[model samples]
Target: MKKVILGLSALCMVAFTSCKEDASSKINSENVAAAAERDATSGDFPTITFEETEHDFGTIVNGTPVETKFKYKNTGNSPLVVSNIKSTCGCTVPSDWNREPLAPGESAEFTVKFNGKGKGAVTKSITLTTNTEKGSEVVKIKSFVEADPNAPAKTPAKPVIKQVQ
Candidate 1:
């Protein structure tokens, strides 16, 4: 019984010592100071300038597809990277965008296709995720879609007339 107790005590001591805080993995003051210095000196963010942020398709026929091109330039000191492009809905698609990083003073263009399926005034927006000062940018497209002619017309009810007795 005494030997078993001694073995148990030795095992507990070994476990406690092994679990002690490791000195080599400790976060020191020097590391914090260096991190602060790096953050303070980092300021070379990219910028994007668009030729036109919005486009109007005027009047379009329903069920027709329309497309437009949006042009942009990197007008900053650093290269601009566009990580993703998303539209307001599946009816709008952004395509042919440059996948590579755009260098300063470089220009690129992308095409946005809209399936003209809605009626009346329709508006959609496209969002771009980029490595720039704003982190993200937005562009818009709008159009007036005419009513589908093939659709059933909504007729008004005829007024009832009552003859005086």
Candidate 2:
């Protein structure tokens, strides 16, 4: 008789634990659904679309400053706000983008200036922080800096012709 009672107690405990777990899972699901509903009723998200993510400066003169602009637009359902812009190195600088929120279908451009300090094949990246769904965007600029071909050639001073033959 005692064994039967113990078995019954064990069964009851198992059932109670399972019910508790189910209730907790249901609550979690309900919370998730509620959050989704709230998001649906709230403002929509913004997306950034660029005409081109990369720009080529072509061949540039070393030691000169060159700038290129990257065009973009807000293609999502909401307005887009630019939060930050950063360059990969100190020699490269990025100009301020549209400070105001860009409404959908509006277009703008961000300018990047790279001091033509490096030579040979050069590549730089500019990172943009925005209210985009992915949170960030990256733009690339590449150039081949050629040594100034117009630099004057050095001429050796004419050897002094000794007259004291």
Candidate 3:
């Protein structure tokens, strides 16, 4: 009876040790994958992809504000966390992100507003910093404005003034 009890205790210890090793192996594998991804995207983010990399507001009237949305999804096996988002100019304001963690198969939205006050062609860029093994990303938003609200209308020339009497 004593021998049987000792053997069962040994078997239980072996099972626990095997489970611990298995768990450790899984964690190590994840770490390796993350490191590889980081190396691949050393300069720029390759794991994090945006649905629309650019937004073009062809021609907007002066004083008008145009808002655009940038959407992205997490295609990797880990959670996606956006660390920071910055706009090049003050006129371009990015809405506050919820700062929620995105799971493996999730999506998020970032809203950006462009003030079309400046004249001529304007091109602005938004920098996104994330924790998807890659470091940061840049998304561009472009707009063209005529500025002059009273530009000559395309109406046909009015009849010439009556000749002086």
Candidate 4:
């Protein structure tokens, strides 16, 4: 009779332990799924990564138009969408990029135009809006412009034929 009671107690303990393990496993699974969902919808959807960070336009003569292009890839797993782009000054113009939802393997370009009206070293920036965690991005375009000094002397050394005889 005592043996029978001991055997039944052992079986009950085993069954209870198994049930507790299963319940804990379910809870852990739920937590994992919740974490994944939170990561996905945390408003940090995609990323915009560029191949080149800095661009130099070299030297441009005054009153000329100079432009440069920036290439980039959507390095993240999700699609990258670029919204609005703004230039820091009126002398700098950024061509609008109408392409949307750049896939993980795709690429894009942003063209920046700088009017060589200003003298000395010019530094400008273009701001981009997107669905990234940072919400926006900025790219810099720079150049050195100098006024042309030889543009005014055309007929100075034409003919000095007066006292040759």
TM-score of each: 0.70, 0.66, 0.61, 0.64
TM-score of 2: 0.66
Q: What does candidate 1's lDDT look like per residue over 1-165, in tens digits?
A: 999999999999999888777877888889899999868756878889999999999999898899999999999888899889999999999999998999999999999999998989999999999998779999999999998788789999999999999
Q: Per-residue lDDT of 53-119 in model 4, one digit per residue for the tens?
A: 6678878888788888888888777788888888889998888585578888788998888887778
Cα deviation in Å at residue 34, candidate 4? 11
Error of 4 at 38 (Å): 5.7
Q: Flag regions of model 1 displaced more than 4 Å.
A: 1-41, 150-165
**Top lDDT hit:** 1
Give the clash total for candidate 2: 0
Model 1, position 111: C-alpha lDDT score: 96
Number of colliding residue pairs in each model: 0, 0, 0, 0
What digit string (tens of lDDT, one per residue) describes model 3 on residues 1-165?
999999999999998777644555557777899999888766542256689999999999987889989988877766678879999989999886647777877888899999887888989999888876556788999988875667666788788887887
Query: Which is better, 2 or 3, measured by TM-score?
Result: 2
lDDT per prediction?
0.93, 0.88, 0.82, 0.82
Clashing pairs in 2: none
Cα error, candidate 2, residue 84 (Å) = 0.4
Kindly indicate the candidate among 2 and 3 with the higher lDDT.
2
Q: Model 1 — which ten-residue stretch has the worst lDDT?
A: 37-46
Give the runs in model 3 whose Cα sits over 4 Å from its true position: 1-46, 151-165
lDDT of 2 by residue, 1-165 (tens): 999999999999998777545555556777899999979956677888888898888988988899988899999888899989999999999996888999999999988999998889999999999988778899999999998878787899998887885
